[model samples]
Target: MTTYNLARYPERLAVVQLGPGSEVPSWAESSSVFSITATSTETSIICASRSVPAKTRHHRPYTAFAVVPDEGSADFDIASGVTGVLVALLTPLADAGVSVFALSTFGTDWILVHESDADRAEEAWRRSGHTVAPATPA
Candidate 1:
């Protein structure tokens, strides 16, 4: 098993896009924060993180994450590879002067970035041996 040092992991940022079109929503504000919790059909609670107002004229705010699954979790083996993948990706971004916010979960890691930073971050990741495809229309 590979050992990880959190401090050694590189940071990245990602933003959540709401609404449609390549253009950002004019009314979408990120300063406002709210969260939703729902009951799963399996009788479990699914809690969502609070989303802050995320839109700016030129840049959108995104949440960053470094996801690590719970100890002994069934998916830990696969999820563990994320750290190495992320670390490889982050080095170049830092060199390019990108700021990042990172978050982690039992299932996956999330990297939030300002909308302005997204394109560049993706480019850097691609150069660093990761395949980050553009987000398709939702």
Candidate 2:
């Protein structure tokens, strides 16, 4: 089984959607937890701090948790057609009645659990035999 170290972000986040031509807000660029996905039709931006303007369509007050391997260890390497990795992680959270908003990149996965459920989510992962640790400095 793969071991995961989870890091909880301190600030609140917002998921904002804007038209393709709209520029990303300047505040988003400097956010501690910022992610933007753009396409021809629309753009989605997840910002760690600050509120979106009233005109922007957005969901707010979400919390982010990063699931990474221990420091100095190799990444999980799930890019090579691997399976059951995410399912294993998420099943416990679901069983604990925690809903997740997940994002994946080549190296690690980020799960956004509602702020109210953060504690329960962490407890669920722990009970499932995963090691949860504070994020080490990069």
Predictions in order: lDDT = 0.42, 0.76
Per-residue lDDT, model 1, residue 130, is 55
TM-score of 1: 0.44
Position 33, candidate 2: lDDT: 60
| Global CA lDDT computed for model 1 | 0.42
User: Worst 10-residue stretch by lDDT in candidate 1?
Assistant: 40-49
TM-score of each: 0.44, 0.81
Backbone clash count for every predicted candidate, in the order shown: 27, 0
For model 2, the stretches where C-alpha displacement exceeds 4 angstroms are 71-81
- Model 2 residue 91 lDDT? 92
Off-target runs (Cα >4 Å) in candidate 1 are 1-60, 63-83, 135-138
What is the lDDT, from 0 to 100, of the residue 54 in candidate 2?
65
- Give residue 47's lDDT in candidate 2 (0 to 100): 88
Per-model root-mean-square deviation over C-alphas: 12.0, 2.4
Lowest summed lDDT over 10 consecutive residues: which window, candidate 2?
Answer: 71-80
